[model samples]
Target: MMITQVRRPATQLARLASLPSAASRPTLNTPWRRFASGKSKSNVSSHWFRNSFGFALAGTATYLGYTYMNGDWEAWIERQKEVKKEVIDVNDLRADFIQEKRSLKSPGVYTWGSNAHKVVAPESKDSDVKIPRRFKYFNGQVLRDFKIDEKSGAAITENGDLVQWGKGYSETEYKPTKTLIGKNLTSLALSESRIVALSSNGTIYSLPISKHDQGNGPKLRESSWMPFWGRQSTLSYRVLRPSLKLGESVTLIRGGLEHVVLLTSSGRVFTAAASTEHYPSLGQLGVPGLSFITRPSGPVDTCHEVTSLKGSKITQIASGDYHSLALSNDGRLFAWGDNSFGQLGVEFLPEHPFNDTPSALPLKKLYRLSIYSPKVTSIAAGGANTFFTVDSKRILGPEEDTTKVRDLGRITADTWSCGRGVWGTLGAGKWIHLQDSPIKVKDLSGLGEYDEKTKQMLPIRLRTMSVGTTHVAALLNNKTNLSAKNTDALDKSSDWGYEAFWWGGNENFQLGTGKRANLARPAYIKAPSESSKTPEPEARLQIMPRHKGKVGKRNVSMEQRVECGRHVSAIYSAV
Candidate 1:
């Protein structure tokens, strides 16, 4: 088509592109660069596109250098200072929990640690208690089975009256409000929003916290209906007549955040939903059907028996906030529910983080408790940890007598523990969580039994032990090993052998060892100061009144009680 001597546009463009590569095009001025057909990029330093890229690269380097000058994130920086918790030998913690450990004769109640919400009496002082001080309100009252937590407290007085206190429990922030929960209730347990009590005649009762927890709260609700769940709130403690076989009656009861564990006199184990509509089933119920996937639609009033341990005669039972343990008469230990911190005493598996079925702890294979089959006589669960007292060698000395006067206190067990190891709560050392096997709590163990050959009492025997979320408290019965000459010169002061030894987490000064630092092993805690009014500003150390009582002298020591809650510790030493 050269009729008019004009070439097609494509042909003309191709001919131009074929011209000498570098001498053909001209440069344009704009925000961006545009290259012509045969031109080579020469003065790109002045080009807008190249200049913008250079500016971006330089700015990136400058920002990186600025970032390097400053510290990393606050959390990261703090994390660097934290060394993984190792086995710290707390030489002070395991001195002993005492026997005959009841101050009922004088009824002294001591409270220490986090006082937030005034869970303990002296409500005016809002500061955390750094030392164990006698509880203010109960001067003349005789409270038994006294249990408390961050929110509330419940106890059965000597008169068989049920009382509740705290802004979280009965809305009585400053005083102990008497709540006639149920007639003849012997013992009770407290949770954040629920309270459970057991009657001597094998009945169960429950009380829900009205002010703190909305009754039948949303999460615990069943069905989508708004009114049904809302009306589920209960004010008075009502008897939970959980269906039992003809002769089955609950002999023991313990409470958790959302459930209550029941051990029947018949050696059967059962669990019922203690809280409704607010908590999810985390296998704490120990019932296969009650789980996150098949949560109950409403209040699970039925007592679902622990099926996995069906045939065994479960003698002792314990519960943490989310886990449960059952001890059989044969000294076999079974655990279920939450194992997030290895509280179940079994190795945690990623595929199975929590367990609903009861499983045995590998005592011989893993822990090697004395190279023999573990004789797990007693077990305790709290927070995310477990405590076990193995009667490895049966020490038979005392005769069983039901009379209170004949009560000689409990045996100091060979302590073993596993699970969340923070603050040395496991009593093995400040260790990583979920120890592969239960470790011998040297501080709490190694003593408590009468040496068969020596026929002599150990220095101290763990009489009473309280396992809390982050700490443990023991009332050690101080044994007298002095000669007859030393006995005559005994100092009969108000504070004899230190009444208590505390170990583990002190975040809220719960350990009451005076210093907030936790004791990985056993450490000595001073008896409360005798000074009143203006309490001494500093902690004082008293070397145990140089051994006085004769080696076999009848220990006329005043009995004391040791108890601890989430962040509170108590030593009832009214004597």
Candidate 2:
């Protein structure tokens, strides 16, 4: 105990001890490294303890890192979800904008650069079969009738006006040449003419063949071969009479082969059949019994107060090669004269004379063929064939049912027929080859090949149609066929398209195929100088004739229509 105090150092020494000299400071040379001395053992033990503490701290740090990762997973997931939602929202908005644009467009109205209607030009048999320049049509006209003459080399109107392809003053205003030069018109029938000009006032006039073509003027002379009567303006002219009438100031008249039909401003229909008192054995008068009689016939009057039959109201009268068709005031159609082929419709003929005055034969039974108990809307006649339509329900199936078609109590019947061999007129493909019965043209069949097992029921949508002694012409509303939708009639490798088709005799290029050969099936007709093509076979339907001209606005000529028999006549309304 006494010795312990003896070794105590001074204050300065104590301070010095707290701050050990550089040399006395703990050297790296420690006993802990020796691995042998007791002091070394103590140092080793302390070092081991310090190392253990550091290792424990590192382990704790690692454990804390794992814990942080596991506990913060929800936050990380939420952030990821936020980013994904933003991307999804942008995509959805873009898709919505695109869909909206598509819905705003209009459906089918403007066809790019085609007539959409009418047959195209016929295939050229030679370079001599030149294609003509076509003009875009004005509204309201649906290709009523047309004609082409290879000899004239120029297409003119039925009124004898130069409507297309000429030089200088005779040319049209636009790209295609269509000029209307005043000429003596012989008459007026739709787009055709037979009216003549009154030479006195340079006024165009029309009359029955019984009337005189007299009067003299700068525009016309009584003896002039042409029959147009009117004054001329600088560029064109003003019609003194667009149509012809019976008395003083009548304006329009129509001739149906042996019968002459007249229209008055008062909306009256005056018919004058060639009476059997003037001409002898002439088919131009009336039916056979009256063929030798040649006097004006009648003013077959109606009680209805209707004016525009829409082609229905006694608005028109046509004669087949040997038949007659009359359009009534309310669209009721009446036919008489010939009925050999049932062109007079399914009816019984009266064995004896029915009346002294010209009265219409009632044909209410014709409605049985249509859906809407058809009211005769328009009528077209062929040589030995006749076509008439009534406003009624559409017919497409074979049931021949009318119950489902009757809606307005009034319907329309549009039909056509033709004689045998000369190919007559009905548009039905090859059906009239030698048959004498009235046959419906094949309006439903297209020009393409099809199996009998898989045939489509086509509807005839004709705007206008006409017939010749050995041929027929028509203006059809271009329509799409629905046969492809019929599973039983589907053509696996063939996709039939919409087009203008014609069939029957191609003789004299009447079918416009530029060939004199005959065609029993429908053939495609091309447009002059046009690249567009008609769909073959299935798309072809009738042998349409082409005539270029204007109607309702001017004079007409005798050549506009050719009268051959007691009921046969051909009209070129497009002149």
Candidate 3:
């Protein structure tokens, strides 16, 4: 496949002189004498004048006759480009990652709220879900890990398969269907029209909700000359090429309204836009010069690293519709993108409101607790608001194990909110315009119980909070018995029962509290009344397994796990 470069005839003259040939020997002696005469009335060297014209003619003739100069070289160059464009699936996932635990089957899920289609429903035609009711459409979390937005949703199932559903998928199937069966996907990120999946081996794949939204065809097979018989399988996904440029594989993936944020194995944060064909991106992609004015030209399938966060090791990421939040290992949080709604949790100038640069929020100044300084433990984000849980609770021995709090969505420290106020998202119980700074949620702050039996306040905690687009729900944890000491025997988040409380908008009864009036302060969401209950469909009713404890095992059950999406709310529990 080698194509030699063509050389001009003048280069042959240099080799001709080194060959000890008589005709090619230097003859400068006669040319210098002619120049010294000055009779030619010209500044040009007589030696060059006599030899240059002939050399130019000879070089042109020689180059035109060269074999590679015809068309083979151009074809060879194109072949090399095709080779560079083709990517091989290396399956290069890093080995040193946290191991995932196996989840039990037939986990029960309760859902309420509405989207454009109102797919999440209670029994019968009741529009309002003022009470927590089991969602029978998808049969609970058949998919272990899932994420949903205002328009679409994606999930990674227990068997490492991918499932998708929502409005963006209207051109395709609108219901939850098994889209990818054998990818062994570990995580899912859904944007407007695309679903980015992260495999167990760290490879990333982008799948389109509709066939027309696909960026490019699937990667070429191993042999460049392989033929297609059109008999194998449907080309539904494309391999993303960020790792080819970043030189690192991705470990995590999260979705925003129109942008997706992923963390690499090296702790680097990267962001990419949804399919530009179906959605327009603001500065949400986090790239400086790639906004509306300079929208992506070709397919929007590459991940651009956040260079603004170069030196910091970002451990976690969360995002709203147009803003993004990155949490560092040292409890430092950085905010960027659209701030007009104050979703970035920081102040901006009047003239210039939105910022694309990553800026750190002053966690140390805004929030601090006594005894143990508030170090951020975890972060959660909604359409226009964010939730930060900071715990100073330190444990010394195995009795102090609390790592499951995050997996269970339980918070041990005070949580705060800052964003738009149209839907009472700030939990301030009033209709304000916006909040650009951290404000303590009254129901979630300064929470310490008083045990009259001990004549003192008990500090045992199991509180968990879920924030939706307009409302908020929490499991107060105030009802749990105080053990005063962490013990292996005192387990089961449900045994330590939770009091359900909610606040904010009630247009769709998304707050799960019966009645239409909005709740400014936290109120207990009632269980479904016997009179309001409809007959259970034979196809949907089943007897859940009894909750039992294994002698040496932990995590008996998550009976009331809270979840919130855009105008949607749900509480999931184990079977």
| Local distance difference test scores for all models | 0.64, 0.37, 0.60
Q: Lowest-lDDT window of 10 residues in candidate 2?
A: 106-115
Badly placed stretches (over 4 Å) of model 1 are 1-105, 170-174, 211-235, 292-298, 366-371, 393-413, 448-462, 476-499, 533-559, 573-575
Task: Report the Cα lDDT for residue 431, model 2.
Answer: 46
Best by lDDT: 1
Comparing 1 and 3 by lDDT, which wins? 1
Q: Report residue 491 deviation for candidate 2 (angstroms).
A: 34
lDDT for 180 in candidate 3 is: 70
Q: Give the candidates in order of lDDT, highest first.
A: 1, 3, 2
Model 2 over residues 330-412: C-alpha lDDT tens digits?
A: 76655555545555553324453211123343444434553334455567665556665544444444664556654333222
Off by over 4 Å in 2: 1-260, 265-267, 271-313, 320-323, 336-372, 394-424, 433-438, 442-460, 478-499, 514-517, 520-523, 530-575
Per-residue lDDT for 311 in model 3? 90
lDDT of 3 by residue, 517-553 (tens): 7776666654432234542211211112123322124
**Looking at candidate 3, what is the lDDT of residue 400?**
41
Please give each candidate's TM-score.
0.65, 0.42, 0.63
* Candidate 1 weakest ten by summed lDDT: 95-104
Residues 168-226 of candidate 1: C-alpha lDDT, one tens digit per residue: 75454436766653357777776656777887787777767554443333322123355
Q: Model 1's lDDT to the true fold?
A: 0.64
